[model samples]
Target: MNEDERNKNRMSNKVVNYVGFIDAPLNAKDLYPYNSKVGGSPVWMAQPPAKYSHIKCTECSGDMAFLMQLYAPLDHLPQFERSYYLFVCHKCNATRQGWKLIKSMERPRQGYNEYEEEEEEYDEDEEEEEEVQEKVVQNDTKNENGDDDDDWGVEDGDDWGLSGKTDNNNNNNNIDELLMKRDKMLKEEQAKKKEQKNNKQSTSTSSTSTTNTSSTETSPLEGFVTPSDPSNQYKECYVTIEEEVIKQQKMHGGGKGGKHGYVDDHSEMEEWSGESYEYVKDRAFSKFIKRINHYPEQVIRYGFGGEPLCMSQAGNQMFDVKTAYACKRCGKNKVFEFQVVSTIITQISHNKDVSSLDFSNLFALTCPNHCYDVGSDVHNDVIYVEELLLVEKSI
Candidate 1:
């Protein structure tokens, strides 16, 4: 027998030990009775129960003390294409992904026919055709596997399967690295585009300035009513400076738990009448409360209710308020009301061209909540706005 045949023979008779499977050897019909083809191949039974100690989980270093099976016929080389086993801890099957060994099966060698082997011309054509077909199949498999390389990278690492589990911190690190790599690549691409844009702008500017220098001096601002107009021989042109109008754009509040610089106080705005106006006011307050919950600051004071009330848009801060209330079991009735004191909204921008600037709007308010006991006097508590709602504006 040649090497291939020798390997096949050894595998057929081999009795390698494994971790999980049936122990007894059953006939093909017994194991897969309903299968169309039984062929005479033997099917092995599952192995008996066994204990695994110091079974360190691949992800965690904790010991596993579950009973599992010992599989037999570890090498499925001759008749079978691959071998498989289960290293499952009965309690935690979520961490267990079965192990599979994809070993190559021995191919049967064609016998040498002296008389037929004389047709070498025909054999060459057949061999070439087979080689071309195998090449095509290999190329197809490679193309399919190459798609979405990022996702497949996780499977390539050593500590992935149940036998070699990864810890939470290591997994987090891997994720962070992947994100950082992606961000770095994106930044590099953006920088390249920006550099190209700057180069183009510089080239355009040089060409325009060169052309202007070659021609007669002509003021580009000739059409505008400039302050330097020579025909200004009349009434003093008082500069009618327009008061800046701030148009606010919606902003999502920051995350929870941080130092907040502002508090929510809307007591002054409460004086507005009518049901329709009151509804709008309440809506605004609700939106403000939602925004505050997202702030990163830990020291934010909302109204007297423990609910998170407001958020500071600019920095590390959130404000929440907790009101003092009698227990629900108490018979006396109590009422709580909140009021706003002073209010201010401001917009500031650094850009010279009004249309091109990135500007922000801020809203500041001072509010107080008054609690009245059914038969007693009123008690007042103040919630101050320390953080400004620095919101970006358009136009």
Candidate 2:
């Protein structure tokens, strides 16, 4: 019948599950079974004319992960094939669902069918004649070898033992010749394989030399060249600014029982002014002077536990800061501390209309066991921006 009738018949015959596990990458043609898994490379079916190009998470401003897709074409609307896509953000509880309609092109004409043609029936007499001819040929070959029952007792000019010896020698000669031919063929094959291998190696060496020459000719700008030594390669440091501040506080007698020790109670803490302000500001600048020179001044925010806060949920409400995970290197959960680099504050205050009175706080979690060495290839720590507000503006 028509496409719709065919689809209905097929659907009635079997139920299709549109869900699949993602273990590897997938493409459009690979989705033919109506349902399949996708990993790494997912086909972006939406064309340029569609509303949105790609999906993004609203909460964390991160790219959304592709979960599943569906394709269905109706008979009446055969020209327009609709595709449904589902995306999810694991860090945040956000779901982005949408669909796109792609215009289907006309299908090409099919070739001829062979099933409609008729076949001739077999003839029993012709088959019997063929079988008799095969038997006659077999008998003639036996006669030439003198293996027939009628010629078994016949007396030749030579002795029967001599005749048997001659036949054995002929068989041995034929076997030797066959073995020699096989050896020759095997040697030729081996030689051909060796030549092919040499050719491949030469081509590969030439290609590698060409690539190296081109790279050298390009003469990449300074600071952009990748280090040839593995030890010099860039790696992430897991150390946080909070841990550094605590260490400095202890070193400068600002820890517990010391004259400049900070109180545990938030209500007892003094406002930023005079000596307190200068101490904090100096500590921040000294700690992050190197980093300030290397990297640009910008706010990088991250979340750890609980549902991620969207733009609406991120107002004045204070949320619990999630505990940082264990050191990925030593697997030890101990010695983890929080610290803040004050250089960022100083840099921002100087650039903006911010006064010393405008207070802001940013903290990072760090491991104490020298786990923050970038050269040793340690895992980077997860740090979050807790607060960034002007006291007067907030009030």
Candidate 3:
């Protein structure tokens, strides 16, 4: 079999099947030894009073899907008590892990009664005495076995002098044969164990040698069509408008500072409301909007799943960008869908108080493969921004 097939076979042999409700919430019935939920709602930070927000995948710029929330509590250190939030973007082969420390309420202590303390001490003493008695009995049995050679003239046999069966010679021969067989079987078992150990040592040595040889070699081709000619493709493209073109184009009043500019009638403006609005309004998208608000000269519009002005876009065309890239490890392409365009960040830096920053548009992408193999550290290979547009506006 091939390397991948061999790996799969080994994994199958080692896998443990668990059947139950995944991502179940902790309740009174489920106390002690907490377990993290998988692929469900995230438990946000409560001590700092933070809201739930989707983290953008670095590779794809798409919103990371919620993977799990781990609840770890410490008795002595309350500050260390935290919930870990894990998210994944399968397309980019990446993971976003975050933690939130929560404050735990002090549990009420039971009354320390003198009588209860006495009873506990008494119970522990009784248990110790019983254990001592058991050890003594075991010692006595060992002594009897050890002294058997002197008493019966045989080292281990139970037939002490053949008391009533002195005349039955056939029975004695049969017992001797049985003892011999038992000893033979035990020796054979020991020999087999030693052989197995030697085999394992040899296998390990061979494997180590093979690994060292393979490490020096380059990685094999993944079979994906990566273009050889670097000059054929450009990383970025730009569009510059002249003063005459701006005057001829139709103007609209929607940008900051009541600026008049050409608006694409075919393009649509998406508005995030309800829970989504609350989640993103305070995060990166909020900062992006504020940056745009400071600039009054440029007008912008959002576009999805198309070429950046002139160059042709690569990859399979789905209904949306969400279902573009699937999981490379488990090969689960249909079950889980990725979050398409949850949030967008313009090239403008929100940290600066300047009038405007460079760039015309921004986009985020995500891994199409979601919730395939839980807890596996598969590659997060989501695609980030491919091409950047440099627009020079002429008034």
Candidate 4:
């Protein structure tokens, strides 16, 4: 069999168009510190957003548990260091994001890469963990008899996935040598020059968001403990994404697939189909099932700014986003970033009562403007912005 055939899982449906599918679920602590992961407490980017230090459930006024963290730094908003943190309230399930969607964004530290020095310490262990993670994903391709679940990643000859910021912490070698390598990678270029902006730009006074006044406190979770609530917590797993391959697909209306995927005059159809919004919802609900049937195990779809595989017709679609879901910090319109599928709850915990977290999909809309900036103490401060997120329930 060719390499593509070799890597194929038992499922026949092939993932194409460079979409990121999370794989190799492992304990969050086993992998690199800066990588994407599900469950467990968050690995804070800089300092924890103080206001969120104690998030009470909107449903029951109880504490929330950490659900997952996605390391999705946008290229468009490269100056800011970014990561998405999800939390869930255990007291009441199906609260539809009554828990929270917190986004940590701040300018890069003025000195060296924030994670480089720390990550280097665990180079040997991290490399070994990655090997184990790969093996776990491979084993998932088939049953004991080795049949079924066949096409999980790029088909044909291509077989690599581009994880947006998975490799942010450049590892190994002399400290100086590692930093030198970062300058060469296109992805890390923005991070390198981010902290060089010494001259402070005038702050926006028109619509200033004072909720996240910059703080320099060390992460609160470092030594603190919360009331023991086992049901709210979940097992940890590192999320590794593989690229979906480009392929040909005959489009409706006598159209053809693009270089990446099929396209059409889909300005409106892309958002929703059918005449009435309710009918559009029915069409979307049907598609959701059919789509998940092929790759039901996908915990997340990570393609910031790219289209989110819809789980509903009204999933944050029926709104003037600027007015309804403006960025709490920048006051700019939030755009679709990535999404967490309900399948994640299956992998989140086996012991915990995850019943309260019911949803078909959780669509995260983030501020593409990325207007948050580090305070004078860039080395010590952090900016945590509350982003927009919505959950789609079963139709």
Distance from true location, Cα of 147 in model 4, Å? 65
Q: What is the C-alpha local distance difference test score of each model? A: 0.28, 0.30, 0.30, 0.54
Best by TM-score: 4
Candidate 2 lDDT over residue span 1-395, tens digit each: 12233244221101121111122233323313223122222232212212223445657755444433322333433333222233334454211121111111122111101111111112433454466456445534554575533222423313233343335454344334434654575567656756875796699668867878755432111111111211111111111111001211222555575556332222111232334544644443433333233333322222111122111112112322343345565665432111112222333211123133222322222232323234532111111111111111111
Best-first order by lDDT? 4, 3, 2, 1
Question: Over all chains combined, what TM-score does candidate 2 have?
Answer: 0.23
* lDDT of candidate 3 over 169-205, digit per residue (tens): 5334534554565457556765675687579669966
Winner of 1 and 4 under TM-score: 4
lDDT of 1: 0.28
- Weakest ten-residue segment in model 1 by summed lDDT: 337-346
What candidate 1 gets wrong by more than 4 Å, as runs, is 1-153, 156-163, 215-395
TM-score against truth, every candidate: 0.19, 0.23, 0.21, 0.56
Q: lDDT at 376 for candidate 3?
A: 29
Best model per lDDT: 4
Q: What is the lDDT of residue 283 in candidate 3?
A: 38
Candidate 4 versus the native: TM-score? 0.56
**Residue-wise lDDT of candidate 1 within 284-316, one digit each (tens)?**
556555443443121112122222222222111
Model 4 residue 383 CA deviation (Å) reads 1.6
lDDT of 4 by residue, 304-337 (tens): 5555666676653643233456766677777677
Of the candidates numbered 1 and 3, which has the greater lDDT value? 3
The segments of candidate 3 whose C-alpha lies over 4 angstroms from its true place after superposition are 1-66, 69-169, 210-395
Per-residue lDDT, model 4, residue 337, is: 72
**CA deviation > 4 Å runs, candidate 2:** 1-62, 66-166, 212-395
